[model samples]
Target: MFRIPASNNGLYLGSVPQSAAAKNGGTLITLDHDMATLPAVGRTLTVAELAEHVDDMAGRLWAAGIRPSERVAVHMSPGFDIYVLATAVARIGAVPVMLSPALEGESVAALLERLDRPHLLTDGAKLDGPLADFPVADLTDRTVVATGSRPGAVSLDDLAGAPRQQPVLLHPDEPALMTHTSGTTGLPKLVVHSARTLRGRFRPQERLASLVRKRETVAIHVSYVHSRMYLALAVLLPRAMPLVIMNDSEPAGVAELFAETRPGFIETHPNSFMEWEELVDHPRRPLANVRYFSTTFDAIHPSTMDRLLRASERRAPLFFQIYGQSECGPLVGRGYTRKNAHKADGRCLGFAMPGVTNFRLVSRNGARPSRDTPGYIEVSTAGRALTYFGEGERFDQQVHGGWWRGGDVGYRSGYGCLHLLDREVDVIPTIHSTLEVEDTVLGRLEELTELVVVAGPDQEPVPVVCTRNDRPLEAERWRAAVADLTPMAEPVQMPLTELPRTATMKIKRIELSQRLRTQEGRAS
Candidate 1:
């Protein structure tokens, strides 16, 4: 068994023994563009191999001047190398600043500028054009370790021969990972997590014993830079060999990999799961080995959950849905089984994760009320981040004392399940009353192919619905739909052709809202 020091201060996240995997005879599997084909169970690296690689990589990073507590930026595709580098950084007592490869030009540049002078570890081919435009040289004096050959870049192979160094003993409170908040409001804020906080937030003990027994083959299809990887690996590692899918995690790609790898469990975002639904012709494949599926990052529409349940042949338990923010960590999860499916109102995020956390609901208008009363959800947990980096004002407003205000308004049901109402900004207050405009729009347009609701600058709600056909939605049908609601919310039905979205498929509500206001002003 791996033994990490029980320290209240200076907790280091990567302090667990590197050789523990080798001692237990486990393995590590990774898939990337460099591989001849998707990695299968038999072809994956053994635990001994992974531990040796981590040791070698850590030594090389130290030789390259990555001192303890220094931050090393990792901008690479998901794979075995990514995990190795992350583990290596931790073993050396350095922080791993993970950046999603899917992040676009401006977001990437903004993040890089915020984390100045970081030792970068990346797949150089992915960094060719867009990253070259930035003042990379001035930002960091450190050298980059590129996985593949690139002009003026050092290769990973060169580091294998580097001399090994003693692992740094770090306190539990030391920052281990740097993650960015979802840029939902303005620029994305940086969040710093410590080893103590992560351990407390994600109680790795409960799942470890079972996971070890199964020795399950697991596939991590989400971006390693995201919080999902941290949550999944921290819980899955003691027992199973994690298969990292580095390239596009689209359904077609993931299905092909699944067919080859035969992983017992798969972890991914709801969007990727939906994409997978569209790619495969058969709802149920010969996925005899697979047993569990988990989703996070965003809420999955009930329809998408239905599709997943059907596709898995009801062979696996209901897909697990986890809800949390980058600052608060993962706070809640629900198992989507047939027994609980009918009970779900498509609103309850789930009950709290038992022991590691607790929650409170503070009214948007400032009063604490009973169940059925909607208010902003505030969470207090041991896993909450220590501080928001570079966003003092925003951080102060959101976090008061130990309670982090999650801006999203929700309420508890009589049955003790938590139901998310809407985000503070997403709620529309009409002349008569307030209403969760987005929830109503999404529920009403359930039959539509796609839909998004944006609050216009005039503070009016506009619904953009995409249907399979090009036919326009009639004025009467739109009016009737809005009229049937409890608190009447004004709806402007627009074609889907006019909507804007982010790289991760989130609607750009602010931009669309601005456009709507401009058009309304012109008409007036």
Candidate 2:
């Protein structure tokens, strides 16, 4: 369904930059922060330069003994280098397992064990900080440090003059990359992806990218470990779009970068966009040149969408909200303009991509699914991950007849708009959709930077709030805002930093709920 030439062949992460460089060596890529691996290379580079760095890193890995088809887990210090390193691992024909830097040391060690002692690529910061208490030596086959040296670890710097090896291309169906789930329940699961499967995830996004008639700089601030980041590069690089990779999400830093870069296309996690709401009024008009604002992680608040859309001076600026999961790529989405964003229903996520994707709501009870009684939201797409590495049975439970049922409960509107209500695990007896309540209250109270509703110790719907700048939340204002909505527990105001978050900035609802329960237990 996509006209992009790169889509014809499988979207192989290993060869993406090389192919792009071959097509257009001059395509500019600007980064907000310096790369960890290439510390002296500076922040800006051409497509050719990036490909060269990837090739050099691949040679380094080859010297380090990472061979074709072997698994290499990448859990290193934060930077844009993670993607480059993962790509380097892929170039050598080994699957790059992406473990988010935000993952706890325990979780990382556990995931390393799950990979059956895969080679680990990390940095000394992690070795000395979060991982200081864990016996990392017992969890992996070999430890390769990308930066700094640790005893019993191979350093990439030591192999600077290693001979370059030809890029290895595995079978389209062979595992090429692995990323973990958000781990809201427990340790994250390793999601396995192949060249062909990654291509599946690329097509819909390719079609979306095709919508941009003119070449404008595309700025992206997504988790370095996410499949979306790779797919986004697959779409942008081959097309030779000028790219800006953002490492900072702070409002002031983002303002300076966006103002200086003047990116026309911007994409980030929904929560990041919410955090950027303050940028709307920046004197420099940081978002003025933006024509498209896109987010794929979760349903964003209408207010946040409206503010960003209005900030753009471009004619017909659009905010695209794509509802998707880690396992299945972009499933359904619709764009909103300033004219309609304020009135848009937070629950009514858009329609599925025609031909490329399809969704079905399986009944929770004997009756058919509807607004009141949401059902299991399952999707059938080529973009679905192959399987959970080393957890085949757990993966099997979610698949039925080629349909992947992510643990989400939602219904479809009469007009076929998918309405996401709540995750099955986060559902409370007192509320139909915790997310809907959050969206409503957040839109009503401008002071709120974030809001989440989780099941309290008594199964009561508790609303957890984080105000802008961590200011005290006015009791009367909050009461007035939720007056017309469902009854909720007393608001628990906390610093935004205290809320548990995934790499992509998604709130760990289950973790937050567990903390609430623990606090209640202590009080009693």
Among the numbered candidates, top lDDT falls to 2
Tens-digit lDDT string for candidate 1 (281-334): 443363435566676666666655655555554344456777777787777767
- lDDT tens digits by residue: candidate 2, 396-511: 99999989999999998989999999989999987878989988888889999999999998899999999989999999999999998889989999999899999999999989
Per-model C-alpha RMSD? 4.8, 3.0
The TM-score, computed over Cα atoms with residue i paired to residue i, of candidate 2 is 0.97
Off by over 4 Å in 2: 1-9
Positional deviation of residue 218's Cα in model 2 after best superposition, in angstroms = 1.1
- What are the lDDT figures for the candidates, one per model? 0.63, 0.91
Query: Could you tell me how far off, in angstroms, the CA of residue 55 lies in candidate 1 after the best superposition?
Result: 1.9
